[model samples]
Every structure is written in C-alpha cells, then in structure tokens.
Target: MSAAREHVIADLRERISLLEGGSARKVGCLPFGVPEIDAVLPEGGLAYGALHEFAGGGSGAIDGAAAALFAAGIAARTKGHVVWCLTRPDLFFPALVQAGLHHNRVVFVEADKEEDVLASMEEALSYGGLGAVVGELVRLPMVASRRLQLAAEKTGTMGIVVRRWRRQTEASDFGQPTASTTRWRVSVMPSDELPVPGVGRARWFLELMRSRAGECAEFVVGACDDKGRVDLPSGSADRSNTSGRSVYSR
Candidate 1:
C-alpha cells in the first residue's frame, strides 16, 4: 500500500475508535483489558476495520447461547447502536442485557434467508454509522465474507459473524477458509465454585481458532459481567505457548 493510503486508513481507524467511545490515543483495536488475552493479538486488541468470525463449540443450545453472549458482549462495549442481522428471531432480550448490551442499543434485522442476512450485514457495515454489525448464519462463503471484510475496511466499522448451526454436520463448514481477520470458538465451562450453596458466575472456555498475524491460544475466563467484560479467573494462566504456534499446527 502507498504511504498516502496507509495514512488514510490509519486516520479513519482512529476516528472510528473515538466515535466508539474509545480513548483518542488508542486506535485500530479494542482491547479486552486482560493482559494475557490482549498480548496474543498483533494489535494488542481486537482490530477495527476488520471482519471476525465466531462460533459455539457445539450445536447444543448451551454452547450456542455462550457464543451469542460473547458477540453481544463485544457489541455492548462499543459506543453507538449495533445492527444485528439474523434469520432467527429467538435472541433472548434479557440475556443480552445481562451481557451488558441494552435492547435499545441494538437494531435487529430478521431476514428470511441466509443470503439476505449476509447482504444486510454487508450493507450495514458499509453504512459507517453503527459501532458494529453482527450476523448469524450457518455458512459464510469466502466471497461473502470478503465483501463484508472490504466493507468494514472501507468504513472502519467492525463486522462480527456468528456461525450458528442447526445440525452437527453443518458445523464442518467452519473449517473452511474465509477473509476474516480472526476466528473464535466459545464453549460453556463449569461455573465457578461458590463457598456457599448457590452458583457462582459462569465460566467460559475460549479458543482463538484463527488469526492473520497472531498466535492461536485458549483461555478460561469468567463470563461477561454486566459491563460486557470478561476477566481471567484469579490464579488462572494464559494458554499461549512460548513459540506462539497456530492451533492448527497442533
């Protein structure tokens, strides 16, 4: 890329970062605040102006709910309203609030087909007004994802694609390549143990499945708090290897 083009992209990134309630000095990425998790990414945070892919570890409802909450928490942290496009109308409103995303901050688009969902996501991402755009679908073709990535890059908006499968067999598609900047898989883990007789905060097993210029790693974290933030449990360690190898290499 030319120097002028690079400068323009950087400026746009910083502008969008500030517009999304981030500090002026911090541009191009959204840090998760946990040192261990942030250290693995090349940007020390989730990059802006990019497309990210996420999916549950399994097809079961519990795993799927975990994945949805993960995306919801991310959207919750941004400043402006969020546009979420999906074929399903079954997202739990209260759960989103618990994940720190208020209902008023989200504009949901219910499309009739997967193709329409992708188209809506691409359009919303290009609008350049929202903090982020989210889409739920079972399959994301490379071409469609590339279009979304380009739209995000053009406007400095983040795009999140949550892969939701109704059948286990459909999940095989997730292994295919895409234009996403990163890919993640979230699974529900046993809740934290409480000294008393009640349940503690939920825990999650997070897998960084792919990254363009970062190491793949895993983490055990307390689920999203009311502020849409996840924390490394006390005494837990980061799972990145010293060599920073990709998960696929393992």
Candidate 2:
C-alpha cells in the first residue's frame, strides 16, 4: 500500500477503463435506489457502459422468474427504448410490465438461435441509440462477451445477458469465465408473513457471484415493485456472505 504502488495501480485501472471506452475519472452507474444493495457494488451501482450477466440459482420456475425479473427491473430504470434479443419467445410481457418495464418501451427480437441473439444484442448495443440491450442465451463464452462488452462501452449502454438453460446440464456453462463486468444469480424466497390470509410481496435471494474490482456478496430482499425497486426487510441487516472466489478473471 505504498504511494508508489498505489500510483501504479491507479494508472493501470485508468488505462483499463479507457480501453473499455470509459473514463476512470467519471464513470456512470445505475443505482438500485437501495442503499444496502448499492453499497456492495464497486461503483455504488451497476456500472453503465459495461456487460452484466444474470442466471437462475436453480432449474426451477421460480428461479427463472426471479432472475428474469431482476434483469427486467434494471432495464426498466433506464432512459430509452430497450432491445431484448432472445432465442425463445416465451417471455411473459405482463410480468415485465409488473416489474416496471412497459411493453411500449421494449422491442423484442426473436432469433432462431443463441448465436443470433448475441449477434442482435451486439448490433443493438453498437447502435448507441437504446438505453439497454438484453440477450437470452445459455452459454456466454469469453470472446462473445468481450465483443458485447466493448460494443456497450463504446455507446455507454448497458448490456444484460440472462443465461437461460433448458436442461440442468446447460446451467454449468454459467459458471464458466466471461468478460462481463458483473455476474448475478437470483432465486425465489418465501414471502414474508402477513397478518391476514393473503399473499405478501415476493422475496428473493440475490447473489453477486462476480464483479470487476469488487467483492462478491449476497442479499435477501423484497422483489421489484411497480417502480423497479426492491425493499430491504425491517432492520436492514448485513448479509455479506462470500467465499472470496470469483468465477471469472478480472
């Protein structure tokens, strides 16, 4: 932690940021509007002009729904139209609307294969005209992710990838290395207790599996509301459980 060593590290970070088409001096972020969640992210929020990956914690209906809603919530908070490229046309538009991304603002591209979906995402991101570009893919290789990351950075657009797998075996690919800025997993948790015989707000277990220049962490919070925001349970306890391991290289 000497001054000379610190300076070298800072210089390297700046150079890397520049190469990624962002400035170290002032980078943009998309805060979740929740203090506890934002604090865990290196930049106090999800970094803009970068690629992020999301996947279900397990091969369950609830797990897939939670992960998709998590990504949709983030996209809902952005400014322009959203380009969502997917190989399957099974997305529930009503669920996305409930999560705050209205149908009018989304342009869905149905592709025949995962490769096509990635190609469409890269093209949309490179267009520099949308608020965010989302892709549904089962496997995101390092090279493919790198191209998507670079395209997003050049336009200062957010790139999101939802890793969807039809079989349990395909889920293993999500643990592989990718060039994304961060990776996340979301699983459904039991709803909070209610006084009456009625359903309460949905809860979720969120895991920050990987991040660039940041530590991995996890949290349990209420699911996204109509405003694309999550709420911490009463008391806002710290749930920073991490194994100190990263699935991807920095």
Candidate 3:
C-alpha cells in the first residue's frame, strides 16, 4: 500500500495492457466499438482477464440464442481461438459465422452436465494464447463463477458465461452476484422491416445489469455481422434521442 509501490504496480499494469494490442481502455480493457456505450464502461470498454455473464430476458428460446450470439460477437472481436462449452447441441455454426465468429476459429465441447461444462471452460481459460472461453450454464453459483474468474485472470483470457435456463424459475438464480466483471441480459427485439416487406438485420435489447466499474445502461443495437461488430439500428439516422436507447439501475 506504499505510494511508490502502488505506482510501480500501476506502471506494470499499463505495460501489460499495451502488450495486449488495442486492449488499452484503461488496463485490461478494450473498447466495445460503440462510442456511447464504451464511454460509460470501466476502462471505456469490456475488460479482458475477467468473467462476464450474459442471460436471456425470459425463458424464451430466441432470448437464449440472442445471449449466445451476443457473446460470440464479443469473442470474435478478440484474437486467437475460442472454446465454447455447452451441454446442448442446439447451436448452429452458420448463424455464428454470420455474427463474425468463424466456424474454424471455434472449438465446441459437449458435456452432459454443468459441472463438466465449467471444468472444460476453466481448463480452456487456463491455457495461454486463446482468445476466449465460453461456458453455457443454466445456473451459475457464485463459487463457480469466482473460480472461473480467477482462472481467466491467471493468463489474461476472457471468460463469458452464457446462462441458458431450462425453466423460467431457474433464471431467477441470476438475481444473485457471481463476482463477474460485468453482466448483461439480452432480449430479442422485432427487427426492422424493409420497404420490400422482409426482415432486415437482427436487433437486440441489451441490458447492462451489472458493471463493477460502471453504471447500468441499456441499448438497442443491430446484431453483430460477419466482423463481430455491433451498430446502431439501420433506421437510426440520428441518436439525439438515443435513437431509442434507455438505461435502468438497481
């Protein structure tokens, strides 16, 4: 806790951030590429070497898929390979590819239960040179999430927990803390209709439920494309009114 000692530690953190390339939001941080959104996040963006949680708004099928796709897009933004652990085989690679997470860069592990999934994710995160490790869970206890966080920190890998609840009641577990760096609740929104009468791009209602270093915020963004980028809605010519963005706090 000495002043000089603290300064030395800070310098070392900054140096590490620089070595990571574009992950220099503050320290262990990278911009989400959304100006307004990044402005409010700690380090001005999501942090590396930490655990983040994503969940659906309800028990709806599309809601869970939206959360997974959102995490995939974030992972796509990072470098190296991605390991996603899930109990179910419902994930379709073609949709992930459209979200910028190319099929080749990803490795999927199918487990029969949550314990296996968590174990696999922790192992993947411990490995060096991986971009990210994702674990799908219906209920993540604080103890489990903390272990994952510590593992990710050991090597600077990112950990994303995609909470996929099998029942509406199970999702209630999300109300508790997991000591994660950040948490988000994603909901599907009606896509914009083209003049030709068909779907445009997918849209999402992103709720920033928890931020260790930021205030809670909400946004409606166009789903990630082939390059892992989130954008304002195509119809949003102006955002003086947030283009329909909202924020909530607890």
Candidate 4:
C-alpha cells in the first residue's frame, strides 16, 4: 500500500475503534433515594452520561424541594460531590442536609438565567470528577439538551434536569428528545405514620416516564431515616384501579 493510503486506513481504523468504545462504554450510576426506584432502573440506579428529566405539574407545587433532596440524598449516599444549579437563590440547605446530603459534598450555583444554568451544569458534568450534576431549569431546548447529553456521555457523569412545572410544557410533553437514557417524574405522597412520629415517614410516587430499555412502571416508596433515604413501604397494599393505574389513597 502507498504511504498516504496506509495512513488513511490507519486513521479510519482509529475512528472505528473510538466509535465502538463509545458504544460499549458504561456511564456511572446515580442511586435514587429510593431503593425500589433504583432497582427498576437498568443500572440499579440512574444511568450516567444521559439526560434525566424530572417533570412536575406546577411551579412550587411540584415538590421541587423533595426532588432536590432526593438527588442530594443520592449524592450523599454515593459519597460524590453534587453540582446543583438553581435559578432560585433560596435553596433549603438545611433541609437538604437533613435529607442525607452533607453540606460539604454539595456545591450550589445560583444562575440568573436558564442558559447560564444549563451552561454551568454542562461544565460541572464535563469536569469528570463529580458524582452527579443536578440543574433546576425552567426549559431546555432540544439542541441544548443534546449538547449536554453528549458532554455527560464523554465524562461518564449523570445529568439531571429538573423542569419547573410552570415553564414550557413541551419539554416534558414531547420527551425533550435528548441523549437521555431514561426520564422520571417524582411526586410527594402522604407519609405513612411512624411510631415515634415527629414528621412521620415520607412517601413518594416514582413514575418512570421513559426509558431506553422500555420497561416502565410506577412504584410507591417511603423515605426513612433522618436523611430521607427511600425503601419499600411495608403494610401498604398495592392497589391498582380498573384503568391499570396504581393509586395510593391517603
């Protein structure tokens, strides 16, 4: 083979190898606050290198605090640092610490604009050392989300986008079309009574909205401990209505 031809072939081979490696590469897992939710996910936790959207019904009504705490709990459990980007400057840090996220493990960034939040989140995810990146954004354009997804994939880090309920609904309605491997919606449920009873137990509904592997189901999980880690709620009967939807009545 001519020297130039040999060089071209070698370059082509290297490109092919990279493509294969990327496909086979596994992303890190962000363990959900709930064990059952983690079990349902393919990786036994939130898959890394992908976009995971948490959709809620309305602003301030979507349980953003609980959701943030949940993500924080995962970061704490994994002993990984969390880069939290929020538009609202008032994040309940004490509550987050109570939810199992250590104050030292979290780095809070308050972004004034949605674009800045996304940009900062992408940078955190790409920094390659953090366990997970959590961003509270109102809306994420498809193109921007795709870029963030690619960045996550490159670093093998988990990216979570918490969409405010009052923002553009299309981002959650049409599935945002990012490189995310899975999507989930979390809502607060009435807590089961505890024997000691201070705040009682915390309950939540975890709905797997979308998944690349295609097995999606709704599960009820209860939070335990001072840090609010979740587990299967005992004595709670599984009730499925005629429409095949699981309903938990308070």
lDDT top scorer: 1
> Tens-digit lDDT track for model 1 on 11-68?
9998887576443321388889999999999999888889999888877667777888
lDDT per residue, candidate 2, 42-127, as tens digits?
99999989999998788655577678888998999988889999877778787888889899999999999888998999988877
TM-score per candidate, chains pooled: 0.84, 0.83, 0.82, 0.73
* Candidate 3 or 1, higher TM-score: 1
lDDT of each: 0.83, 0.82, 0.81, 0.66
Which residue segments of model 1 deviate by more than 4 Å? 1-27, 235-250
| Better candidate number, 3 or 4, judged by TM-score | 3
> What ranges in model 4 sit over 4 Å off?
1-36, 57-62, 167-176, 195-198, 224-228, 237-250
For this target, which candidate reaches the highest TM-score against the unseen true structure?
Answer: 1
Residue 29 of candidate 2: its Cα lDDT?
A: 95
* Selected candidate, larger TM-score, 1 vs 4: 1
Per-prediction tally of clashes: 0, 0, 0, 1
Candidate 3 regions with alpha-carbon error over 4 angstroms: 1-27, 234-250
lDDT tens per residue, model 4, 130-188: 66788887667778888889888887777888765444444344355655677666667
State the RMSD for candidate 4: 9.0
